[model samples]
Target: MDNGRAAMNLAVLLALIVSLLFAQQPKQVVVTGAVPDAAGGSLTITGENFGFVPFVTLNLVPLTIDAVGGNRIVAVAPIKSMPAGTYVLTVSYGPSPQETGSFQLVLGDANDSRSQSSSDVPAPSISGASTDAAARVADRVITVADVDREWQRRDPAGYLGLIRQLYDNRRRIVDVMVADELLAREAASRGLTTEALLKEEIPKRTITMPESAVVSLYQSLGDLTRGATLEQMKPALRAWLERISEPEVAKMNYVEELMKVSARAEVFLAPPRVQVDRTPQDATLGSDSAPVVLVAFGDLVSASYARFAQAFSKLTETFDGRVRLVFKNLPLVGPGSIAAAEAAQCANARGRFWQYHNAVVLPPGAVDAVRLKQAAADAGLDRAAFDACVERRQYQSVIKDAIDEAARYGIKSVPSFLVNGRLAPDPPPFLPPFDFLKRVVEEELSRQTRKP
Candidate 1:
């Protein structure tokens, strides 16, 4: 009997100790409420055991309470500065917390509220009910043609005024067309119709777009349109936005007009046109029988040179021997730098001209005597032959002849290409490069075939 009583007492003590341990642990509670403003606005919090001891965290901000006497506590929300724009209020206590749907904090103005309400309100539309003012206005103009219908509307001034605005808008459009016609007539009378307005204006008005601006604009379009492809949209959008925001709109308008004039005007290029003598007279064509001889006038040192080379190479391949590429080396390294031109000529002699050409033109290497020799060796040219050519300055005359050729073609820059014997003004946009070159080559070839 004594042994039994002792065991029973021991067991009772162990149970009491376990119960105490459980009781001493921290008890968690739910914190519920709308975020409160210090300015007399109350956010109702619905949760249990929001006690005064420990602080409750709203978002990442901590809110302290004196006590939670009841399950429902109206904690006057602290003067918390919230982020601008819309956000969901996430209320929490302890480790795990809950979110209280979405809430919005707008510009603290009555007008903003009114605008929000107006946006929410349904307005009649030509297609269906609309909440957009711009859409509604556009629809009303399109559908409501009858003057009686316009007058019978509840808001007479609003509706009739809108109608009148539409009429006036159309009248202005007609006026603009008439003005354009008159301008064209005047240009014809003055012999200005033959010249392109865009061509004339771009050089005068084109703001050299900052590199950062171009990149930023590219990124912005990428973000907005999702899949609209930057190359397709960038030039047009950049011109449009810049025209509206920058003070350079007039210049842009002039350039646009020049383009329009160019589009409408007929171009009569003479046969067997004197191509730019930028390259050497002995500058061999890629193929003897290739009818389309593309004479590329560029310096290997110019960035535009590498760009054009890549484009021209693709064009050569696309045309499949029909296009013979002849590069004219116009060595404009700077005011008096013939070293690069001399090096390019030497490379040409070694049959590794293209290889050395690309190396010097691209970034990441210096174009000097030693570097040029190394580049030639790297391009698989015979070292001794390459060095001799450089030392002797063998192709100086050839280089000069190339420059003369370019001058004859009226070429002034590196990478200017002559299609057949005629000059093409710009490089094809590189996105679908092969297709573009192929199309041009095919068109030119077809035109030639039809001639005879």
Candidate 2:
């Protein structure tokens, strides 16, 4: 009995091992290659495992075969079943199975047709223009082509509108160049152009960009399109929008430079209108006699204000006790912005000013009322009290005081920084020419040390 039982167990184990070994074998099939639909009228998939009579199926679309050839098989991808994208091609014959790799259904262009030759569609060429005009036209063409090429490579089917824009921009540049040359020629023939005036006027470009004009342009371009998608006109839209804002950008750049021209520019030295009697300061801040007080007038909504906070934090760390950083809130974004200010003040009242400030002034989109209240609650402020304070606009007076002070000092924007009683030059990121505050503080420190 024992011998018979052992024999049965060995036979069962052998059958199990054989089943596992067969399962480990790869699927009995091979796929040579798949040609895209455009390469030929039909996709040719070549491979073998056909049992002298191979049966094939493509996504449940069955195929019948009359004969099978050695190491190769041909199957036509169904035109109606497959759209323009990649799809799998499968073939099966009972136990013997094969699956072809991805077959691409490409948009058929003239170039892909077998009857067409490479020489038929010649590459775009630039000719028949004056040297400078030709060069400008060429640059414009290249810019349009490059942008289209990139967008199409990723999203071919969706870029028809972009291609149209490229053509339109090319036409506009061509017209502009032709007209410019004609004007130059006429001016020369009539002797109406002076050397100095021409030189000065050529470089001095005045582009007026009214805010309303940009809003109108953006609207006309379907920025507020009625349907599901905004049209893709990025290349032209970017250049035109930048062009429209040239005057305002230039004016701001000029103002920033003027403020940095001399050590005495004094951006923050607005004429004082009121005198408040000084009350003796508290003992909480160690010694309240710091020589330099850097006041940052900031708004939560404005982009520049966040940048100001970062640079101010760095400067405060660098100067330590010599500089005491004071932040005054403007909170002009909306109700949301005001609520944020109130929340911060509530945290400050609980001796968690720095923690709350850091949390709120974090990268934009990272702050909301929930997170603000959470930070306050974590900082040991009563959640209910903080909630009530924010909802009731308890710190409106605080924001108002900051605004009143700013108005008195002729300040109109957030990120307006005062370093030792002078307004710091608020240059845009691209043209941050100089740091006047740092210079003044360094100069004053040097002067005092020299006197001793």
Candidate 3:
């Protein structure tokens, strides 16, 4: 009987201990409220059974506790220092812990909440509510045709914009249609084809772009090129910089040398005073105080642009601080080419336009969205930001206006130059392309000096 009584007492004591332990166990914490999408704001948390001093963690990093007493605790979110993304917000109570739920740590200023902007409007055309459900049942693999079809079906405006190249070729034909019989006859008399002369003379007059020079130019461009190297981009770099140092190294205007003996080819044409100097916020190179300014309207993807850019690079070096060149977007090739122009503008936003200038050849087959992002990655740009900007088409109107203005100027070709308000004719026997440009700038300088 005594042994039975002892067993009962022991059982009762065990039950009491289990009850005490159960009473001490902490309650599940619920994150009831968090304010402001990103960091740097008060986060309100509540859990009735929490210990006097509970701990809080954000994105696995322990945050400084402000106060933790009662059923509710307030903790300050990390000071917007954490990168922008969705992070798990965990609140722990007492010793026994359980974690759940997340808060999206947004990017950008919290105070500048932009609900009133025009972008706030509902565009159900892109809402794609159907895609949310369709994605699961849709083909796991997407194809070119699928993307194209979906793109056209989803964004009809985008489809129309892509089809409409702002620059029309017929306008250029009319501008150049004045018939250069005199220039043609002069060329024939000299037994020179402007094309053939350049083909032969470019080699004789142009210096090879050295590996060091190429590397120097590439490195000097800074973050725009990112981690690109001379060897990897050698062919493209060589092509762009090939003639940059030629005029300096050769120390002779091969065009002037030829022009001295031949009758001057005078095609009296003036570029319409269309606005080329857009703003200081453009991609530019050379001295702001220079006497001559070159407004270059060139296509990034054009083979002709590569040549023109090289020639212009030479002028910048040869002109003795008397010239400034501004690059205005004239994307005439197509949407892909226009997209490439937009990519350059995106880089410009980051002060990496020169690097992007050199890496104009880095994009994939064409400057599509995927290719532009890849190129941005290759260029070491903030791909997320760049991709977002491209999607927004922030610079579309700016580019379109430049194209429209080019059409107004009757610019139909890839690389058209305006030197101090004169439409620079394509190379004739007397003036090679670069030399003609140099001559125009010098004449402008002379005129500027003579102004009384």
lDDT tens digits by residue: candidate 1, 360-434 = 665454456666667776788887877777778787777677666555455666656667765453432222334
Arrange candidates by TM-score, descending. 1, 3, 2
C-alpha lDDT score of every prediction, in listed order: 0.53, 0.50, 0.59
Which lDDT tens digits does candidate 2 get at residues 354-404? 666766675565456676766775566677877777778776786666566
Top-lDDT structure, candidate number:
3
Error in Å for residue 157 of model 3:
28
Sorted on lDDT, highest at the top, how do the candidates line up? 3, 1, 2
User: Which consecutive 10 residues in model 1 have the weakest lDDT in total?
Assistant: 96-105
**TM-score-superior candidate, 1 or 2:** 1
Could you give candidate 3's per-residue lDDT for residues 322-351 as a string of tens digits? 899988778877878888887788888888
Question: Which of candidates 2 and 3 is the stronger one according to lDDT?
Answer: 3
Clashing pairs in model 2, backbone N/Cα/C closer than 3 A:
268-423
Clashes of each: 19, 1, 0
Tell me how candidate 2 scores on lDDT.
Answer: 0.50
Each candidate's root-mean-square deviation in Å? 24.2, 23.0, 29.5
Off by over 4 Å in 2: 1-287, 364-366, 378-380, 431-452
